[model samples]
Structure formats: C-alpha cells, structure tokens
Target: MYDCIEAIKQRKLKKIEGETFLVSEKHILKARNGDEYVGLKLKDKTGIIDAKIWNNLLHLKDRFEAGDFVKIKGESNYYNDNWQVIIKDLERLDEKEVDKSAFLPSTKRDINKLQEELLGLIDSVKHTGLKKVLEEVFLKDDFLERFSKAPAAKTMHHAYVGGLIEHTVSVGKIASELAKDYDGVDRDLLVSCALLHDIGKVYELDATTFNYTTEGKLIGHIIIGYTIVQNVIERLNVLSQEKKLNLLHCILAHHGEYEYGSPKKPKTREAVLINMIDMMDSRMQPVLDAKIDDSTGWSEMIKIIGKSIYAPKKAPKELL
Candidate 1:
C-alpha cells in the first residue's frame, strides 16, 4: 500500500496492488475497430491518476462503482506524459476490509478547534429562539461528528474533509462583523443563517469518496436545507411567524437566483447579505487555494468562478 501517489514513479515500472479509491469509471468504445474498454480514475489520499482495463470489460463493469474502495492488481506506466495504471484484476472491498481514512482527502484545519469555534459562535447568539434553534441543529453529538467531517462540495471550493465546519465557522465570523455595519439588520438571524446556509451539504456530499448521494442528486442542498429548517420550526414552535418565514427565506434564496438553484430570490436585507457572504467565501477560497499560475501571474480561467484569478509574482531578490 502507498501512503501517497506522488511518491510513485513511472520509471520504476512496478506493480501497484493495494487499496485505491474509485474516483470514476466508464465504458468506452474504440472508433474504427469498435472494441470496448473501461476507462477509470483512481485516487488515494495523495492524488488521483487515470487507469484503464483492456480485458474483461463486460465482467468488470458492474463489479464496482464510483466512490468505492477497490483492491486493484495493476502495473504503473507512463502514458501521455502522465502515469496511468493498466489494471489486470480488481475486486471491491468491504467496509471491514478497508480503513476509511486512507481513501479520502481531508482539510488541514484542526477538527476539534474548529468545532469549538463553531459551538462558541452558536452560543453567542443573544436571541433565545434563534439560539435554541441553532443549538438543535449543531449541538447533536452525531450531527457534529458528521458536520466536522463533511465536505462543502464534491469538487469545487472546500471539497476536502472537515470543509463544512471550516466554511461555516469562517462565514459566521465574517457575517457577524458584516451585520454590524448595516442598519436594521437582524444580527441573530443573519449570523444563524450564515451558520446554517449549507446545513444540508453534510448530507449532500458523501465524505468517504467525495461524491453525491441519492438525496444530493435528487433534491440538492438548498431545498434539503429549507425542508430541515421548516421541520425544526414546526416541532420547536419557538420563533414568531415572521421570524420563521424570514429565516426560511434566507436558506431557500441564499443562492441568489433561480438559475443557480435558489427556489426564491433574496428579498430581505438579511437574505441579500447572506447570499453575498456565501458567494464571496465560496469564490474567494478556491482562488486563494489554487497554485497554478500559467506563467502570467494569473490562474487559468476557472469556469466555475466565471473568471481567472490573480496572484502577484514574487520579484527577484536583486530587485528587493
């Protein structure tokens, strides 16, 4: 078993047989000859690499799936300037046979520290009704464990483990300060909304293999989160009708527009602010994390963010 894929070498020409995560796989046919093969992507904690199965395509197609723990028998080779695996045999691994930590990428942030900060923010809310609701959402022992390990997205910003809590704590802190600058903003609602905006994401993204679950693909996090909030309100019966309506509106409309999956547009001042805060954090984090400079001091155009990002080059020491 390899601790990291980056340590593997193409020149060595060795067989790699151990636990590798199945990032994706597909059936493809050759154009002229009309022969079939399975194209696949495999990952470890370090990185992912392309792979292919040339034989037994029909037999292997249903044996595993995306986000599965696969025990592979393959040889590493260089192809198209990258390392690819030519798999000879493969088998799906049961949960008992695999270590869950080896196949996933996690956030570098300290999990316990982030949880403490998140709880502190939840405790700081002065409004009794809102505070109680936040507690019910965040205080559950099981939910905290999952939230602290959940990814914010499958591929985009904050995709690693523990990303949800990292993002939530950051947005809560910033939203708290941002709310102070505006007049007539409900601080409690804004801060709580900031904390709860992506609640459903914990369920939306599968942490083990960083893929979408059935609920994630069917309903998405926005609607899923809105429904959860509605249920909590109904059971608790704490907040007034107006406060409940506004809180639900922020969660439903946080995406800002229908095209982006928000069922409603942000109407109230807090809703608009919540949307802005969410957008800024989601956009800025990915840009800051990117290291590809394209030799021009600008990152390659990331389609998801809508524009290329800038990072200033370090001048030579002579200039300094």
Candidate 2:
C-alpha cells in the first residue's frame, strides 16, 4: 500500500493505495481526446494531492464520493510545480481497513489535559448559578462523551475529532487571562461564555463522519447554541434575570458580527471579550497547521496564507 507522501514524490509508482479526499473541487471534465475525465483531491493524514482518471471507467462515479475511503492505484507525476496522479484503477475499501483517525487533521493540543484545565477554571467561578449551570451541562455523562469527541468545524479551524473541546478550552484560558487585566467584565461570566460558546458544534456536526448536518447548515451554531443554552437555563431554574440575559447575550454575540454569523452584536462586556478570544484561536489554527520540520526550510503551500509573504527574522550566527 502506498502512503500519501510517497505517492506525491513518485517513489511508489507500481501500486498506490490511500483514501480519497474530496476538497472544495469535485467535478467531471472532457479531456483533449473527447473522453470524459474524473478529477479528485485524494488525501490521507499526511496531506492531499491532485488526481485524475484518464477516461470514464465502469461505475467509477457512483462507487466513490467525496469523504469516502478508497484504495487507489495510480502513477504520479508533476504538473505546474504540484504533484498530480493519473489514476489507473480504484476500489472502495471497508471501513475497518481505513482508519478514520489517520484521515482527519487534529489539534496539536491534548484533549484530556485541555478539558481538565477548563474544568479547573469552571470550578473557580465565584457565581454559584453560572458555575452550577456550566458544570451541569458539561460534566454530565452523555454531554461529556459527545463534547469531547465532536469537531469544532466541518472544514475550518479544529475540524477534527475532539476539536471542539480543544478549541473551547484554549479560548477559555485566553479569555480568563484577559479578564484579569480588564475591569467591568465579570471573570466568571466571561469564563462560562468561553467554555460554552461553541457547544452547539457538538450538535452541528455529525460525530460519525465529522461533517455538517442539514440543521447546522440552515440554523448555524449560533442559533443552535442559543436554543440549547436557553433550554438548559429553563430546566435548571436557578439563574437570576440579569445572569440569564447576560449569558444569552454572550452566546449570541460570540461570532462578533452578523456578517460573521453572530445573530446580534456583543451587548455585554464579557461577550465582547469572548468574541475577541474566539477570533484569535480560529485565525491561529491555519498558521499552526502549516508548520514544517525544523530541518526543512521549505514548507507546504499554505493555501490560507495566500500571496502575502512573511519572512521569519534571521537569528544571529551564534544562536544558530
């Protein structure tokens, strides 16, 4: 079986096997010979590469769709400075043969450690009502299992298993630290908001395949989170009028702006703080994911970074 990186280098040309990755583009085209060609963005844990079928083959289109695991045989070549594969054969593989963990990109942080740290912050909240609400929701048997395994996004930042917990914990830590320096922001409220801002993601994405559901696409995480939080508050019957309004406002405004998916602008100081912290974590994901080995000066093309160039400042010769 050929791995993704080896296939890209053309070192394993005889037979290549790996899972098919459906990126943004999946379409059919007519080749120069007037035959229909199928294109694919095949990927595995290491990375992705461009691939194409030279001619229409038997039941090829129906057999494999984007996000499906398949064993492929292809010869590799270079095209316009990027690796391309000419697929000669393909077959769908059993779910057991394909490890889902190997396909999804994951956060560099530890999920368990992050969860513990976040819980510590939650326990420190001075407000009894807010703390109890957060603990009741997160510490439950059923919610904990799903929250710890869910993806933060369908394709954006932290779009892997256990990503939701990682992102929420990271943002919570940052928001907590920021609260110490700023006045008029309740530290407990901010911390609770950070921990719960993306809770809707657990419902938004399908845990089995880590893809968006129809409800996620239509209502979005913001509205879904609001609904979930409101229901929990009603059930608990412990939050004060002011606390309920403040917490709800934070959830609604965590996305920052209506154009950014937030239904309302941040009305409370804690909500504003959570919005900023959330933005920082989301934007930094691509930068962290694009890192290469220390020995290699050249890294993969960061599609998100685009044409804008950033040069790391040169260190002194002694330091090197």
By TM-score, the best candidate is 2
lDDT of each: 0.79, 0.74
Kindly list the per-residue Cα lDDT of model 1 for residues 1-320, writing each as its tens digit. 43434444323346776645655434564635787777877766654567888888778867887767788887877655456788888888776776767566677889999999998988889999999898888776788898898989866678778889999898999999988999999999999999999999988988777778899999999988888888888889999999999999999999999998899999999999999988888887778765444355665444458676666477556766
Estimate the TM-score of every prediction: 0.79, 0.81
Give the TM-score comparing model 1 with the true structure, all chains together: 0.79
Give the residue spans of candidate 1 off by over 4 A. 1-19, 24-41, 47-63, 71-97, 293-303, 306-320
Query: Residue 312 error for model 2, in Å?
Result: 7.0
Q: Candidate 2, which ten residues in sequence have the lowest lDDT sum?
A: 304-313
Question: For all candidates, what are the clash counts?
Answer: 0, 0
**What are the per-residue Cα lDDT tens digits for candidate 2 across 79-184?**
6645677877778777677567666555567877877887898898889989888988888878987898887875557766778888888898898889999988
What is the Cα-based lDDT of residue 161 in candidate 1?
A: 82
Q: C-alpha displacement of 139 in model 2, angstroms?
A: 1.7
